[model samples]
Target chain A: MYKQNITKTPKAAALAICAFLALVTAACLLCLWHTGRSSGQLTAEVYLDGELLWRIPLDQVETPYTLEVPGPQGCCNRIEVRPGSIGVVWADCPDKLCVKQGFIDRPVLPIACLPNRLVIRLCPAKDSSASHAAPDAVTY
Target chain B: METKKLTFLALCATLSLALYAAESALPPLAPIPGFKLGLSNIVTLLLLRRYRPRDAALVLAVRILLSALLFGQPLSLLYSLAGGLASFAAMCLSGSILQKKLPLLIGAMGGLAHNGGQLLTALAVTATPGVLAYLPFLLPAGILTGMFTGLCAWLADRYLPRGPSS
Candidate 1:
C-alpha cells in the first residue's frame, strides 16, 4: 500500500533534478566569486580554434583576465582566459563535465575535447618570467 | 535449501562478473575513478525480489570479491566493499520501510548510500580532505543511477511470475 500511495510522477522528478542543478550552479558561482576577490593580474593573450580572441598586457593590471569567446551561442565551451593561463570555459556538450572542471593554472594543464574541436591556451609575453607558471584557464 | 541457495549465489556471481568485465573494458567515465552505474546491480534487484535479506547479503559479498578478482582492480576492493555494503544495508532497511513495488526508491537510496560509503573510503585512502568536495556532486548522480537500476528491477519483478512457493 505504501508503494501504491507514493506518487512519484516524472514531472516531480524532473523538478527535483532542476532544483539540484540550480544548487550546483549557485555553488560554482560562489566558488568563482571567492576566487575572484583574491585575483591576480592578466598579462597574456588567449587563442582558441586558431583565432586570436583576447590580449592582456602584463603592465596593464594585476587582475585575472576573464574573456568569453563567441561561437555556437548558448554553449558554455567558449574559451576562458586569465592572466596566467587559458582554458575552455563553456561548451554545449551533453555531459557538461568540462564545465564541472574548474580553472587550470599550471603550464601543463591542458583541457581539450577532440569531438568538439576546441582548444585553448595562454601565450605569455616574450619578456615575462617564463620561469613562472602560466595563467589560469577554465574549460566549460 | 542449501543447494538452492548455492545455485542462486553462483548465478548472481556470474551476472556480476559479466557486468564488471563489460564495464572494465569501457574507457573511464571522465578522468575520475569509481564513478559508474554499477550495472551488476541487476543482481541486487533480482535478489531483493526473489530472495531473503540474508541471501542478498551473501550474494553481495561474493559478487564484490569475485568481481574485484576478475578485474585485477584489487586496490579498488576497499571502495567496492564500502559502497557495496552500504548499498546492501540501505536496500534492506528501505525494503522494510517502503513497498515491493517501490524498488526504485530502494535502488536510489542504495546508490546514494553507496556513494557516501565510497567517499568515506576515498577520504581514508587518499588522506585528502579536498576530495570530499566531490561528494555533493556525486549525490545527484547516485540518485539518478539508482532510479535507473531500480526501474530495471521493477520491470523485472512486474513482468516475471511469482515463484511456485509464493
Candidate 2:
C-alpha cells in the first residue's frame, strides 16, 4: 500500500535521527567519566559512539581550563573545558558558545550541543570518591 | 504596459514598506531568529501577478532597503538583503516557469529560498560551517509558515478588489 511505503521512509528517517542522537548521547555520557581517585588529578574522556576521542587530565587544575575541539558535521561545538571544569572549555564548532560556557565539574551537571546533538555530563567514575564533600554537578 | 508596470511596482514597494513598519508594533512570536508573519510579502505576491519580473524586483529592493532603515541594524543587513532577494527571485522564476496560478507552490518555493539565503548569510557572518546542521531543523517550520503566508497573500489578491489597477 502507498501508506506502507510512506511509513517505511519515516522509519528510516527516524532511525537515522535516532542513530545520530544516540551518538551525541554517547558523547555526552563519555565526557562525564570521572578521572580522580585521591590522585588530585581529575581525568575526563570524550567519546563518540563508544569510540574514545579524548582523555584529559583535570588534576591539580583548581582553575578552569578551556579546550576547543573541531566541530563535527553539523554546526556543533566540538568540546570545551572551562577553568572550573564547571565551564565549557571545549568546542570545534564556530559558535564557541558551548566552550564559552566555562567549567561545570559537578557530577550532576551537564553541557549540551544542539547542532552535533552532543552533550557532556559530569558523573562519578569507577574511581570516583564515594562521598566527596564537594557539590555534584547538576544541570537544570 | 511599461508605465502601468512601473506604477504598480512603486505602489507595491510603498505598501510593503508601510506594512513592514506597522508589523514592528506587534511583538515577536519567539525570541529565535527568523520568526515572523512576513506580512510585507502580501504586496510581493500581488505584484507578481500584475507586473513583470523587472518591476517585481524593484518592489523587492525598495521594500528591503526601507524596512532595513526602519529596523536599523547593519548587522542584520546581510541576512535581510540576501533572504529577501533570494525569495523574490525564487517567486519570480517559479512563477515564470511553472506558469501556474497555484499560490501554494509559489509560497513554498519563496519560503525555502528565504531560509536558504538566511542560512547562507549566517554561515558567512559567523565564518562557521557548522551552522548547516540547523538547516534541517528549520525546513519543516519554514514550509508551514510559507504556506500560511501564501494563503494570506492569495486571499488578499483574490478578494481585495485590485488596488486601482496601477
Candidate 3:
C-alpha cells in the first residue's frame, strides 16, 4: 500500500532530526563556552543611544552605587555598580529585560535593551602602565 | 478556496494570535532582545503540513500583522516582522527538506533564522556591530525553544483532523 512506503521513511526522518537537534545543542554549548569568561579587572561602560553616558572603573570603586540614565521619550534605566561588577537593576522600559539580565561580573557580551537604546558592556581593564611604551604591541 | 480550508486558516490564525498574546504577557525568558519561545509557530507548522504553502504563509502574515497592531511597539514590530519573514522562509525550506515529516527540524531551523534576522535588524538599526556577540546565546535559545514548539505541533498533527481530503 502507499501508506506502507510512507511509513518506512519516518524512522530516517526522525533520526535526521535527532542528529540536527544534537548539532544545534552542541553549537549552543560551544558558543556559551566561548563567551570568554575574563575575570580579575573590569571596566563598566554604559552607552545610551550610542553615546557614552558613564564609565566606571570597577577596580577603583570602593562602594556600590546606583544611577539613572535617561533615554528618549522619557524612558530610563537604573544601573547598579559594585566594586568588581555592574548590572541594570531597573528599567522603565515595558519589557524590563535589562533588569532581568541581572549583574555581569566578567567580560562577556554586553547586556542590551533595544527598546531603551541602552547598552552595558564590561571590558578587560586597559593597562595604564603601558601608556608610554610605543612597543611591539602597538604595531601589531 | 473551499469553506473548509478558509475556516481552518481562520482557526489557525486565531490560535497563533492567542499564542502571541499569551507569550507577550510572560516575562522575558532571557535577557536577549529577540529570544522567545516562538510557540505561535506550532500553528504555522501544522498549517504547512495540511495546506498549500501560500495558505500557510497567509495565516502567518496575518498573525504577525494583527499582533503588531494589537500589542507591539513600532521597533518591536519591525524586529518581529523581520524575524518572522526570515523564520518563515527557513521553515518553508526545512519543511520541504524534511518532507513535512519532522516538524522539530522545521521549528529548530526557523528559530535559528529568527534570531539571525533579529540580529541583522538590530545591527542595521543601531549601526552597532557589537550586538553580533549575542549570537552565541541566541542560537542555542532559538534551537531549544524551536524544537519544543515543533514537537508539540508534530504531536498535534497526529491527532488533529486534516482537510477534507483525509
User: Of the candidates shown, which would achieve the greatest TM-score relative to the real structure?
Assistant: 3
Per-model lDDT? 0.62, 0.60, 0.78
Q: Alpha-carbon error at B98 in model 2, in Å?
A: 2.7
Candidate 2 vs candidate 3, DockQ winner:
3
Top candidate on DockQ is: 3
TM-score of each: 0.62, 0.52, 0.67
**How accurate locally is residue A115 in candidate 2, as Cα lDDT from 0 to 100?**
54
Please say which candidate is ahead in lDDT: 1 or 2: 1
lDDT sort, best first: 3, 1, 2
Compare candidates 1 and 3 on DockQ and give the better one. Answer: 3
Pairs of residues clashing in candidate 3:
none
Off by over 4 Å in 2: A1-140, B1-8, B163-166
Q: What tens digits encode model 1's per-residue C-alpha lDDT throughout B1-166?
A: 5676577577767776787778777865643345677677867876777778777777788878877666645556778899988888877776755544467777877777788789888778767565564565566667767778888888877786554331
iRMS of each prediction: 9.2, 13.5, 10.4
DockQ of each: 0.09, 0.03, 0.18
Predictions: Cα RMSD each: 9.4, 15.3, 9.3
Per-residue alpha-carbon lDDT of model 2 for B45-114, expressed as tens digits?
7678665666667788888877767675776566778888888887776666545365665766677678
Candidate 3: docking tier: incorrect
